[model samples]
Target chain A: MESSRTILTKIFTDYYLGAAQAKKDGKPIAYVTAFTPVEILRAMDITCLYPESYAVVCSASGKAGDMIGSSGMGQFAGDLCSYSLISLGMDHAERLPYGGLPEPDFMVATNNQCGTTLLWFRLWSQRKNIPLFMIDYPTGSENTDQNEYVYRQYLALIEFVKKQTGRDLDQRVLAQQAANSRAACKLWSQVHVLNQAALQIDAAKLANALFPIVAARGTPAVCRYCETLIHEHSRENENAVIAAQPSFRLLWHGYPLWFLPKRYPSFNDDRFQIVLNDYTLWWDLDYPAADTLESLIRPYTSTYLNWLPQRRIDWTEQLVRDYAIDGVILHANRSCRRALAHVIPLRDHLLRQGIPSIILESDMANPDYYSPEKMNSQLESFKESILAA
Target chain B: MTAVDPILKNCRSMVLNPHHRRAYLQSVSARSCGIIGYFSNYIPAEIIAAAGFHPLRLIGCFGSVSGPALCDPMCSFVQDFYATQCSGLADLLTGLVFPNSCDSLKVLRQVWQTRPDGPQCWTLDHPVNTDGPALLYLTSQLRRLASELAAASRSTVSDEKLHAAITEYNTIRGLLRQCYAKVEARRLRYSDLLAVATAGLMLDRNEFTRMLQEFAGSSLSQPLSGNPVMLAGPLTDDLELVGALENHGACIVGDSVTNGWRYCSQDIATGGDIYTKIAQHILSQASPTAFDLHRPSLAARAAELGACGIIFLNQERCEPHVHSYVKCAAELEQQSIKTLLIEVEHGRPGLQARDLMRIESFMELL
Candidate 1:
């Protein structure tokens, strides 16, 4: 049987190659944010690509520095979101993975993840002279009006996709896509639940498992990949003897350091096991079963990032209890201000609850802002304090 | 040399000192129903006034606070606002209305709500598009804000009251435009024009209108004498940058900042549903960098203003303006216009020596 890592790599490689071919074949391709409702585009046969995921690939492949430098030459400030900087830099980048993403026919973005997405995508829309459709997600408490607004925008977005691609959305295909998304999400949630049972899964393996969920959520490939992940974890657990539980279980509370995936192993040792991260659990939503257009509104609007800080704090405390997490590692990503804005208050809230947490300041895609020596020293001190507690 | 008028002098003092502005707000709040603070221009000040509350635009303060940081990498404007709130402004205002405009302000709203004793807070969600559906959505948000304000102030917003507020604000906008005309004609200094506009945000509407009417009609001796340049970017309360620009031989003929022309360029129509008209006015104006993609060209505006160069004064760590500057600078360069980009830190007392040197060089190029 093929390992899950190989399966994921194959899935992603095929996806990117297919996108490139679609560009060559003159098919419609839209650059979309990760939080956009892509199933609607998929139903219309419009190929959707994620610049945010592409940026992560560049960072992991060690090409982000060059791309970021190119962006600086274009006058984009280094303080802007590194994901956006890398994506913008790709046009002038000397080296590109997959020969750079094909020029998008159009762009779709949602502000649910961050406000920077709107600005970043708008830059492309203006530069390319392509139509850009924006979906505004109201931050803070959810109301019926907010939900209704989002639902109507989804309807409008479907029309926009149709107009851009000259393809009609098939209701049947959309229903099937939603069902596939729900199944994959269920399986992904089960994987996290399994990790809670046994602290044996490595953090890097889980991070590797995030690609399919983020990239292929509305397709059957994601369901298959998630099933393989579940099977491999269970099979490995059954084959080995009872695993020794680590002394400390830590929860990663923000976006992963994509530039340093290899360093995740340093976290899984005799003293600590990274039980879970909020980034992987972002899509573990209870998608409605009806599979109607209206059904998607709640699931899309109710992502963890869209909630207010208080709600997020409550959710984090619940996760700590549920996973028996000993401490938290907050990634104060310099590139992402929206995510970083709530970190201080969240840290204070956790400390008041008798939970120890430490903030690691770095950029997810830009390694220039990250200091390994400083991060290591902070981690060492955090470990001693957790052990002392 | 001519002596400064008392009205302009008071406006200048208020702009230079936070204490003077706080005292002015206190005096105004004592006579009015209450003072309601708003963050962005997207917020309808008319609605707050119609609710019998004096609307004060909260241009954040300067300097650091002596507490744990609320957020890192936040624009100095928002940081200073949070610092001021932490200091005492939270208790001084009846309520705060935050437009869901930028990421930092949105998160700051949420963080403010986590405080049990924070002022009554409301968020006005803004739509990035200006189509019919967006207009309808924004109108709905305006109506929601009206209801929120009414409940807080215990006063209703009637159509008559709203129209009256609109007319008063429109008058203020007209008077400010006349003042800008003086700047264009080189009859008034641009720095003085900015101080008056900034003071207008904090003063009572009626008092500001009367003061501005007198200033606009008064004869001025000091004339602007330097190379004309248009200023564009986000909300900047840094008067020092303007002073430094003019000191280095640059005339600020016009601006596209939210606190300047963008705030008062258009008047809300009084014929239609008041909320819808307010929505249309906001959506019609040149959008702030964070709000819309299809913004009116700053280069075109600079050309119209007869300025040879543009000074893009962006607050440090402000993502929207930084991203917009790249595109705007490119467009301006294509048009054979000179441009200078200055990233200013808000809490800092004055312009840095390097920034001053850059301004000087940019002026020389013009």
Candidate 2:
């Protein structure tokens, strides 16, 4: 009978509890990025710690700026990836709020995410003097042979983990983990797909649901989390009615401002509501069945950031059309350069289709870099433009 | 001032004059020679040359601001290219190739691909790990790139052509080694040697070799002075920054930057499929790109140059150089070497005075 919020709180609380216990249990921990092949690590029975997700926790708790300040002195640059800076700072600190992360026994990452994470993870490996395993992904999908290379790297990573942990990667376990991952993604996709067509859920509620969707994929918890979220939305829509009959369905681009969630009223408001977000939907990518190496790695290879530019644009255009989006509000986050790369070009594309869009400049974590007054004014102007269009 | 050699004068003109370099590149296209831009120094020029395309290194022009048009945290180097694209200069190229070196460049590849007016763009994996599998993967990537370049240039890059390209580039690399060796030995002025090297990357392969060979053999040596320091970083296209360091009584005896010594230090192995050889050669060198684990060679090169100190100047938001410099500095410090780290936004005019003062203060300590 627990609400989704209560269930979410228990999931997060359990995550930290397990980490604390793992440290005491002499379990080997592998620090990883969100996009890493967690299935393999799970098969190897190594505890995975996602530092980037921890950075979000710190940022939400409003300690990111102070944490980053300490690390940015001389060892790290102020302009380096804020997620990395905050993580490094928290690592070097004597004490932290949510408790310190366990010292990593090893590190692993794939370049499918921004190349920054590869470097960020490398720094951790060097600092801790632990082994680092990597899989280099070619940027686009044109060369399927690139997957052959990745499959080889995957085997190499398995060899590395076996050498380090004295555990072998069982094909049976890998297949099951892959199946679990596929199920999680399928459920996650339903939430976004439903929201795109019908504004059944609000942005804030979806944002809360996306935390577990990002952090705890390929697990029973996330599968249930998604199902519970979808059920709640369905129940809410049973007797639900659009309060204002919003004239414009806008798409929110980039990471949601976690620290300041109330910036825009909930999507239930009469004004322009954010009907979709491409960034959140990126994690909802469905993975093929893991019958072979290619199928096994399909979950990682089919990542949104790893897609070709044309393919990304095509999918986005389809989403915009299906949702009947009036405009797109791209969060020009000061911390994330990869997402900002397509801002102008996408704006121009939407413009050609008679859609009005605006780029709201701010930071995802570092509020010092964000101007609330400026954002408010920009949003006001954007709303006016969308209405006019 | 010493009497400048004629070849040195032309090299200096090209290095100092952006318009002259632009005009020369324009003329290369008029002859129906395909002009392909390779984004970073890590890309093997022999592949493009083998495909009958001029492998023009595309470091954007130095004076413009990207102006709040894109994300604030994006590197200015990529931002400058975006700004230049809007200004219609990217139309001059037959194609563009980007090495998957860092986040900024990777994102720039996507941005360029989205532009309707942008030239044909291809992204290649420059392996971070120098292991056997990494080299093998890079060989496949290079072969793919050569095939793409051949199609773009409307020619076939045969094995024989690739071998010839390798030999030609190796010859230039050999001369550049001698050029940098002379600078380290104080037989050549720091800025003069750099100007010649910078000009070489812009000019035709044979013309650059001819001029650099002449410049390397010339006798334009004035007595070298000032405290010698090795300059190392990600990007150093700003000659003003180099001059500022020199003006502060710190002679740049050697450098390990994208536009500096890393360009010409390594040579391809002879007698192979040539693409595999190119991958081996590129992996053979230590990259300033982040994620490269070992950099003892950088310290060794600085020590061999007899530089009393090292100045690691990097652009802000350039994580690779920033992270690498810390480890490199520690290794240098263990050898009793002094290091100064400076992070700035390159291509901004009128910030030289403050930087020069910092360099001067560091020189005073030396």
Candidate 3:
């Protein structure tokens, strides 16, 4: 049986192989962000690359610094999203992993994630001289009207793809893709539900498992990985009755530092284990069969990124109860304003519900904004708060 | 003093002094039902006005300390706002509105919502893609906002009131256009002109229109000296930045900044429903916030103004302007126009020596 690392490695290695083969076959490569509706491209038989994932790999491999440093001379600001900058910097960097992201024929991004991604994709599209098809996801109430608004935009996107790629969208293929996404999302949710049981693995392992889930949603690869994750956790649940015991379980809010996952557990001292994070759960979406454009637009518009704070609060409160969480760690990531800005209210609500929470100020991708000594001290204090509770 | 002189004097008083302006806002807002404060330029001020509320644009005071909750990488403008709120400066207003203009404002609204003592808040989702559906979405938001304001202020916003508000706002916009035309024709000082525009944001609509009418009708004459330059950026109402350039003899003839031309350049269509007209007018403007994938409107505005050059003042961490101005500057250079790009903190003090040198050098090149 292959280990989790081997699976991750194969997934990453196969992704590049797929890109190279697509390039050789003269297939159109569409660079997309994580929140982009890439299933459309999949239905159209176009190759797609997720730059947000590549940025994670760049940060993890410690090559992000070189990429960032080699970007335009003080052109990009230091305070902008480091993930987007690393992706932008890869264009001019002297070195990159796996020969860096290939030049794309075009790009597509949805504004559901954050406005920064929209701007980042726009800048990249202009710089790369590629046509961009953007789907606008206006924030506010997620009523039927908003769903229709997004559906109309998705139809326009289909027309744009047909015009650009010379291939019309196949409804049968879209339905299949939507069905695949629903299956994968259901399996992913089941895996999280199983985490409610005494899990043998650490939070770092859970976070690592989500990389493929984020980059390969709606694909069989994700379904397979999630199955393996559930199997592994089930086996561990029977064996580690002693090791799974902890001072208290923690519910983490905000994006994690992919490059420095160890920075969190290094100071944990086995006192607590982070049970789950918001980003991993951001994709547990359910949509109907994509026989119609409305079904296709439903999942994209209903993602956590499009949710209001009140809805998010209700969801967070549900998770806190379901996971038997003892406390919360909220990272006010400097790079992620949309996610970071709302966690304060979440923390306040959690505290009112008798769940102690701490706010950690740091950036997820940039190490310059993180201080280990400071974070460690905070962690120590947070541990004491849990003990008292 | 003559009647127009007192009008001009009151306008200058409100425009030039923050303390006096706050006092005036308190006095009028007390008499009136609501003083609806807004942060972004995309919000329809007419809705608040039609709801019988004073539409006060919140400008962060200089030298005010923001809350520690706001950390590094936040542009100074938002920090100043958070500071203003924490320092009890925003207590005079009844409520606030936040538009989806940038990520910083989005986050600022979320943080402000967490504060128990903060004013009532509303967040408007402004669409980037200006299509038919986007227009409908904005119109719905405007209707919702108007309804909410009516409930909050206990003042009904009838069709007549909305039409009246739109007409009043259109008049103000027309007078502002005339003011900028005068500045472009080198008949008005940019600093004094900006002061009048900023004052209108704080004062009553009728009073503001009266002041603008008096200022436009006045026979105040001044020599248009220095190089002709157009200012461009997001939400820069800092008088000191303009004062710095004017001190160095740079004639600010026109601008594409949010607090400048972007505010006064367009008018709501008088034909459609008030909400539809407001949405149409907002979508018609050249928004740097929106990723306008067309001919660079800023460059077009520069060319139309016939200015010798353009000065793009951007906040350090501002993503929208920073992403485009590099390409914008290059495009302007292609048109044989000089461009100066200066990075400064929002609401910070006057320009540094290096920024002054860049401005001077650009002027010399022009």
DockQ of each: 0.64, 0.62, 0.55
* Residue range B1-366, candidate 2, lDDT tens digits: 334566667766675455666788898878655788887777887888888888888753533545434556667677776676666645678888888887778777887777676788887788767777787888888889889888877889899989888888889889888878778777787777777777777678887877777777765347578898998887566665777788779878888876778777777888856777788778877664435533446677776788889888788667677677666766677888888877767555545566677777899999
| Model 3, span A67-176: residue lDDT tens | 77755426564778888888888888866888887778889987777888878888778777889877778665634367767777777777888888898788777777
Name every residue pair that clashes in candidate 1.
none
Task: DockQ winner between 1 and 2, please give it.
Answer: 1
TM-score of chain B of 3: 0.92
Off by over 4 Å in 2: A1-3, A73-77, A235-247, A261-270, B1-4, B60-69, B219-223, B288-290, B330-336
TM-score of chain A for each candidate?
0.95, 0.92, 0.93
lDDT of each: 0.81, 0.74, 0.76
Give the residue spans of candidate 3 off by over 4 A. A1-7, A73-76, A142-144, A236-244, A261-265, A288-292, A351-354, B1-9, B12-16, B60-63, B66-68, B153-156, B219-222, B293-296, B333-336, B347-366
Evaluate residue B246 in candidate 3 and report its C-alpha lDDT on the 0 to 100 scale.
84
What does candidate 2 score in Cα RMSD to the true structure? Answer: 2.7
Say which prediction, candidate 1 or candidate 3, comes out ahead on DockQ.
Answer: 1
Q: Put the candidates in lDDT order, highest first.
A: 1, 3, 2
Candidate 2 chain B minimal-lDDT segment of 10 residues: B60-69
lDDT of 1 by residue, B1-366 (tens): 334478878887777677777788788889878888898888889999999898988873433445445556777777777877787644568889988877888778888888887788888888877777778888899988888898888889889998999999999998888888888878888888888898888888888898988888865567768899998888867887788888899988999888888877777788968889998888886554244422568877887789999898888777778767877877888889898999877666766889988987888888
Ranking by TM-score: 1, 2, 3
